[model samples]
Target: MVPTLNAIRHSRRHLARWMRPQRRPVAWTFRPARAWIRYQPLGCIGIIAPWNYPLYLALAPLVDALAAGNRALIKPSEYTPRLAELLARVIGRAFAAEEVAVVTGGPDVAAAFASLPFDHLLFTGSTAIGRRVMAAAAANLTPVTLELGGKSPVIVGPDYGVRSAARSIAFGKFFNAGQTCVAPDYVLAPTHMVRPLAVALLREAQRAYPTVADNPDYTAMITERHHARLVAAIEAARAAGAEVLAHEDAGAAGLRKIGPTIVLAPPAGSLLMQEEIFGPVLPILPYDTIEAAIATVNAGDRPLALYCLTHDAALREAVLARTLSGGVTLNGTLLHVTQDGLPFGGVGPSGIGAYHGRAGFERFSHARGIFQPGRFNGLELVRPPYGFVARRIARLLIGR
Candidate 1:
């Protein structure tokens, strides 16, 4: 609810400015020419939203398409049936069928929607699904913006003490029951601070949810299958010699809730370390040096976001330079994506293309470069073939 409202306020505040033409200075050779890049609508856009943050993700892109003067067709996830139906109802009332419409469906319908030849397509989901969507879009030569999830990592700087960092990591990791794409999947802790950080993480979880077993504040995993996957992963990690610390009771079978679980030195081959634990489980890896931590992260697929908790300028700069992620949050977590001015998206396997603020408008709108030739131009001088003036101008312009 909070993020949805914030996105609306942000889009309204800046949409007009982003629509204005950006007049550019012509090159020295093209003096007296009028040049500008105009933001033009791409007609119709298709938005395939994910189940997590179902309402916000579906609406956020739709708002951008409308703001850019483009009609939109939204395909809301079938997982959230009730919300999807409500969205379809509300959108149908607010917009003409051609201008904005919602389609609720499962995988087959999604695949059909993805193959549509819209002016542009935006997909938010897993990397595998994003690939299929892109492939379908490619047949029509349609442009696409993919927002996918991956295992984001948090590296704790040596100078920063364990307690504050642990609390922030726990909050970000456990928020939305860790189903969030940007949630920290694991932590790279300093060698001497690994145990202390684990302890602090458990302490913070306990402090936040005193009775997590029955606490209303603690969120349940998105579904029964997701719950089973997390539990099985945890059990696998335990079998692989990883120590697990539960801040509160692990609820009985059939309950979706899983207490905040802290893992210490889980084997790299274990399921918990191998996959994106989109549950309230965080694995901490001890590193003797900052280089080791950075290397460990860079070796894997580029993450959606990277976090470091530290006040040291040198340490911050070092991490910022050596590591690669779509976004970075220093001394905090998950707050970077909330900034309205910055572009929000992932890089490499995490995602392709960006949105939010002016970026969202530009992503949906094509920047048509307009060039009106000047009265006394060199273009005419260089147009004729084999003439002295044309030859001279060609030589001068082409530097041959």
Candidate 2:
């Protein structure tokens, strides 16, 4: 909610400047002509927000759409019905139906919403569902901006202190019970530091949330099914002989909660390693060399976010150069997305496009280039039949 409010303030502050036309330089051959890019709204926009961070994800993009001077229709996840209803009521009262509106329902309604012939569609969810939304929009040739999720990784440099890195990692992983899209999915630590890192992470988790079952500070899985899936993954890793550390028992069925848990060196094929563990489960893997650690990240689909904890300039440069992700937070985690100046989205499978501040405004608006020829018209000399003047001008421009 703070991020959403910040986005609103940012849009209000800079929208006028973003809407102004940008003057472009004219080429030497087109002297006295003028060129500029005019920013125009792309008519109606369709937004399909995910269940996690329902209010922020749903309204953040709407902030961009509105700032671009476009009407929008939002489809909030069914998992958050109450918030969806509240969004509908408040937005409906503030704006006319054609200006802005919210739609709430199950998968069918979502599907129908995606199929609408809006000028542009922006969907934030899993990669599998993003594909479906893109396909539905294909029928109308509607442009799409997909903010999807994948396994975001954290890398701890050899020189960085284990406890310091652990503190930040634990904060990112256990915040909202690790349900955040940009949370650290797993860690690649120096071989000798793996055990120490794991211990520190556990210590930090315990200090943060001493009790998980009834702790008001601790968050639960959004649904019972989500809770079950996380438990199954942890148990699968344990069955595969991975070392498991937990703040409490795996989880409580009634509470839909999973205590902060860490799996050390889970088998490569285990569910914990293969899927996006959108819960309080962090896996620590050992790497003898930083190059190998980087290769391991590149081995999978491009992730949405990457974190590198290193003060060394060369090591940080190497990691930055060799990796590809939607965004990177150096020596920290989850802070890159908070800045309104940066563009936030994925590349390859993780996501399609970016949106935030100026990027969001431009994504929802079209830049139409306009050019006006001068009254003298330099091109007139080169347009006639093969005459001496035309030949001379061509030689001067193109060079013999």
Candidate 3:
């Protein structure tokens, strides 16, 4: 709700500023002719939102779409039907069909909704289903913006103390039990500091939630199946010579509530390292050099967000330059997306396109180019009838 409300207020405050036509510079040969980009809403938008942070994800985009003067049809995740129903009712009370509406359904209904010929479609979910949504939208040539999740990494710089970086990463990784899309998937630490970073991460988690068993402060995994999956992955990593660290368990059941833990140097091929944990488990990988750490991140698909915690400005700038991601949060985690000024989204396999602030307004809009002719405009000299003057002007315009 924090990000969502922030987006709403940001859009309301900035919509007019973004809507102002942008003047474009004209060529010397075309003097007196004016051109500007006029922002207009892309008639109807179809938004497919995900389960995690359901309210924020669905309405954040909706706010931008409406602020840009476009109506929207939102399809909330089936996993959160009750919340979806509440959203529909609340929004219905405020908006008419011509402005905004919600469509609640399961997978098939979502598929049908995605196939509709909306001017634009924005999807926020996992990478696997993101492909399917893009394919379905492709059938209608609907432009899409997908906010998919990837294995975002937190790098502990050689010059920085593990205590500070580990503290930030722990808060991010365990928030909502690591279900956040931009949560730190794993940590890349200096070889000598791997053990220290692990211990520091556990310390931070303990400080945050001392009683992990049924502690309301600790969020539960989405499902029993998800909990079981985390258990299996941890077991697999343990079997593959990875040390798993967890706090003293108030042992009743590991079903929905798994204690915060960290994995020390899980094998490169293990499930703990391969997939986005999206649970209360953090994995730390040690590297000998900065180049190797950057290489480790570049080896996989570009992540949605990269966390670099270092006091050295040169090292921070170098890391940002070498790596590609949807966004970056220096010396912190998950806070970048909350900033209304910066655009947010992923690159390559991480996701597609971006939105937020003016970016969001523009994403759901078409910047229609408007060209106005002046009384003395000389463009006619280079129009259809090609003569010596026309040919000469054309050549000049083409930089020949």
Best by TM-score: 2
Q: How accurate is candidate 2 locally (lDDT)?
A: 0.93
lDDT of residue 285 for candidate 1: 95
lDDT of 3 by residue, 226-300 (tens): 888888998888998899998656651464788887989888998887887888888999899889999999999
Candidate 3 deviates by what RMSD?
A: 1.7
In angstroms, how far off is 188's CA in candidate 2?
Answer: 0.4
TM-score of each: 0.96, 0.97, 0.96
Write out the backbone clash pairs for model 3: none
Error of 1 at 363 (Å): 0.4
Number of the top candidate by lDDT?
2
* Cα-lDDT of candidate 3: 0.89
Model 2, 319: alpha-carbon shift in Å?
Answer: 0.6
Models sorted by lDDT, best on top: 2, 3, 1
Cα lDDT computed for each candidate against the true fold? 0.87, 0.93, 0.89
Clash pairs, candidate 1, are none
lDDT per residue for candidate 1 within 153-246, as digits (tens), equals 9989888878889889988998887889999999998889989999899998888888665777877877899989988888888888899997
Tell me the tens digit of each residue's lDDT in model 2 across 74-156. Answer: 99999999999999999999999989999999999999999999999999999899999999999999999999889999999
